[model samples]
Target: MGPVANVHADTLLIVGDSLSAAHGIEREAGWVALLRERVGDAHEVVNASISGDTTSGGAARLPDLLERHSPDIVLLELGGNDGLRGLSPQQMKLNLRTMIEKSQAADARVLLLGIEIPPNYGAAYTDAFRGVFRQLSEEYAVPLVPFILDGVALQDDMMQEDGIHPNAAAQPTILDNVWEKLGPMLSRDTDRNE
Candidate 1:
């Protein structure tokens, strides 16, 4: 074997929940993994996603990771667990806001990944939860993807048995959705020192 490749020599930290954690799928098949594959030699992806984690959980963990990795960019994908647990949308928003602000303070560019709840949750709550991301993105002036799941969420075959997480087959589509917005950010090599 030749020398092991250091894919993430320049890291991009991913802070999120089970959906970002890849849940039932192997780590390599998750969207983050797909991103690593797509980004190739240009960047390294440091996934800090934890299964069952909420926005608050991610907020709490952000400081240490930020200090450690000092990533060039952050893929912030939280709030889904907060929605699933029926937490107040305001609290979720606050948690996400805190995370986004912290990343900015650390001089890391952020890409906020929005999430949606099932229709059964009632339109009002669903709308409020979905709206949090848009509000935060506008407030922080950060780029946002309207929905992380995109093409995978409603498709039975694209999801696992849980119907919440996407299957490996669906990762490429997810990557495409994320890349649509994130690609531009990566293309511009913003000097971290500036």
Candidate 2:
């Protein structure tokens, strides 16, 4: 008998804030763009990021995006705008959890991208905000990248004039950070189970 072959193109949906929205950067130069290069033709990436989007906003819009894209994987990169706006961490957690549940219900594998608050924000609130991602990752048992900006967030030269958002030059590093955890998930046979 001939060997059974398993080959199916996957789709990735990225939902996040300005970071993923390619704010002040060319769409082709953002990390998501770089990610496309890394994944190649094995997957189609649909970026649903919106500038200034919060977890609440992402939660609200997620269903529509999921319906439209019907992606195999969903990269959830929200909460940065919520932290910047000083919104309640609990509310951010709620919003993110709801979005994750909705994506899972639709049979999409999820990669939660965590973000850190600028040190200027009060330590307590920032810690709580950061903790939310960890808690949800544990709760949902999904893979998570500890910090999406890792190498770029602290580098002055890598940031934009506004002191937020990575410059085009730093996008490769961001893509690397995300791909470190996300790549294996995408390449694994289990991803096909979705």
Candidate 3:
């Protein structure tokens, strides 16, 4: 854990909702914390996730976060609340775009962590909801983790009683999912910083 020569190029900021917030688990046991441990002081990880936060909230709060942290990478794990609440996917997309643009303008690399709503929401609506992340990734040229909870969400043993959030045991898997995209980003950022 050496001192970072440039904080802005070594800090990793995560703006997300309950999933990233570690809603029903210990803070240190959450996937974000696991990510912190995995990085092992290579970069500072700041978790600014708020439970029940929507994309609109993240968009509204991003400028302050960017200005404060000057992160090299920004992970967005929002929109689950919006989908759960049946918010318009167009609005969600716009909000996400705003956040992405802001992060890019701030010179930070962006990673989109896509999430899916339950199948009960009807295929058309669910598809649109999921498509927002893909479209944004394409339009903005940012990396996307197609489904952050891909394996954990469906497994009963991995999920919490509410069935929405993953349990403590699932943290490692979540970190692995995020690391798939995030690892490369961190390497690139490190190379650039050096």
Candidate 4:
């Protein structure tokens, strides 16, 4: 969709890991790029994702990103790498909560992009990691895209050879998942501005 007629665009800053960094693929083929196309002139999408970044890294870098972009929306997509590394879920939650609190303090609406690690991580750990996003979203009153790679991850063709990152073909599907929650936020933001 194109920009809303005569509506001012909002800046959307994405702070994520390899999933949003378009690892092992063309940068333009990443889901964040697809999101730029989807929102058109309605919003400015800033991709600040780093390959192999964890929640702790995101927490440390967020203040800089927030100051640099002053985004109307901040998308949090960290924690996957933390889970893959077997980091403590409690620490991950603390890092995420720190990011969320910082973003809200800066007056940027936050959107948590939930992530689910492979079951190999064990039910106890994986469940806790997955629940962090939900807990934070509910606690902070922010919107969440439950499992950003929802329709894409399970499909072999949609993923890259490593099976960790989604391929170009899966970008649109990932964007659709984010759009489900993001669209409403955009609408509400636009309405409020008017």
Candidate 5:
């Protein structure tokens, strides 16, 4: 429900693209906002997601975000835009790795959000792009949201007109996907702290 009694809140910084930024939907109707409501006083979500952000852009900006928020959890949701732009998966992996390394170095636990582009991007390319998150997560020992838009992305009605972003109705589903993994981390950490 709301805040879990007297649990001290953890600052969560979200660095991503349109999915996390609430591109075509009202800001309050986005998943990030819903996450704030879900966690209530148990967590603080600092959304730094931009509509067209890429892995490189996120890597470059991460140092600043890490310094600014000093978040206990850093949600990494980039790479979708990079895939859409046909960027090199190697470079994308490097960028993602950099961000993960940097955030971990800053003492913030990272939660990499795995994203998959449409199959039209070709099996090889799309697969590699999707693999980067898994590789990075394993290398860094970070928790990951397997697919941030899992249930939302496939449904036509769940997506926006552009079919790229999720509709307002899908925000809750998105939150549920993230919460599956994230909630446990928060709960365990909160338990240890208390």
Candidate 6:
């Protein structure tokens, strides 16, 4: 993709799946919106997340989103759908890498938000899935939120009836997870406003 001349350092764009899309919850209740409130009125937060979106889909659609948002920071919260579909972690990593590269090419810093699938996927597969984000983050030299679910994942109260997506109560905690890794990565220009 060709480079775009405009990059909004105060703009935060999220390219992700259901979790970031607020699958079964209110859009205002999602972590991305909460983060906007936390970051204050200075930064523009754009949510490009879609339910059931795989990394491949994210990779494919990111170029346009990058150009449209001109984001300075891109938060990638995908791969759970890929793992659930039993897709290869190696290939998922490739897709994630492609998205990160595209974002970086557009002069936006990327933050990889990691996730893990159910144990039913088998230990080896699950472990490998987890490792993909770590490897990509280290290789790309980007900040990573190891697991966005954190303390909320398996808890019945924290999740929906499907036991996959987190409920509204878990959103604030989710925002904390993102903020931990994402806060330090915000540009110096936005840092002052935040």
Winning model by TM-score: 3
TM-score, predicted candidate 1 vs. hidden true structure: 0.92
| Residue ranges of candidate 3 with Cα displaced over 4 Å | 1-9
Q: Which ten residues in a row have the lowest lDDT in candidate 1?
A: 185-194
Q: Could you tell me the lDDT of residue 153 within candidate 6?
A: 97
Q: Write the per-residue lDDT of candidate 6 for residues 1-194, one digit (tens) a residue.
A: 99763344378999999999998999999998899898875578999999999999999999999989899889999999999999999999999999999999999989999998899989999999999999998999998899999999999999999999999999999999998988777655655655
Q: Please give, for residues 1-194, the per-residue lDDT of candidate 1 as tens digits.
A: 89987543557899988887889999998888888888877787899999999998999999999999999889999988899999999999999989988999999989999999999999999999999999999998999999989888989999998888899999888889889988888766634323
lDDT of 4 by residue, 89-162 (tens): 99999999999999999999999999999999899998898899899999999999979999988799999889
Better of 2 and 3 by lDDT: 3
Model 3 lDDT per residue over 125-168, tens place:
99999999999999999999999998898899999999999999
lDDT of 3 at 45: 94
What ranking of all candidate models by lDDT puts the best one first? 3, 4, 2, 6, 5, 1
Candidate 1: what lDDT? Answer: 0.89
Q: Give the poorly placed runs of model 1, Cα more than 4 Å off.
A: 1-10, 190-194
Each prediction's total of clashing residue pairs, residues at least 3 apart in sequence or on different chains, is 1, 0, 0, 0, 0, 0
Q: Over 4 Å off in model 6, which ranges?
A: 1-9, 190-194
Candidate 6, poorest ten consecutive residues by summed lDDT: 185-194
How far is 77's C-alpha from truth in model 3 (Å)? 0.5
Q: Candidate 2 at 111: error in angstroms?
A: 0.3
The superposed Cα distance between candidate 2 and the true structure at residue 107, in angstroms, equals 0.4
Give the range where candidate 2 is weakest over 10 consecutive residues by summed lDDT. 185-194
Error of 4 at 18 (Å): 1.0
TM-score (C-alpha, index-matched) for candidate 3: 0.95
Candidate 2 vs 5: which has more lDDT: 2
| Candidate 3 lDDT (Cα, 0 to 1) | 0.94
> Tens-digit lDDT track for model 2 on 21-101?
889999999999988988787788899999999999999999999999998899999999998889999999999999999
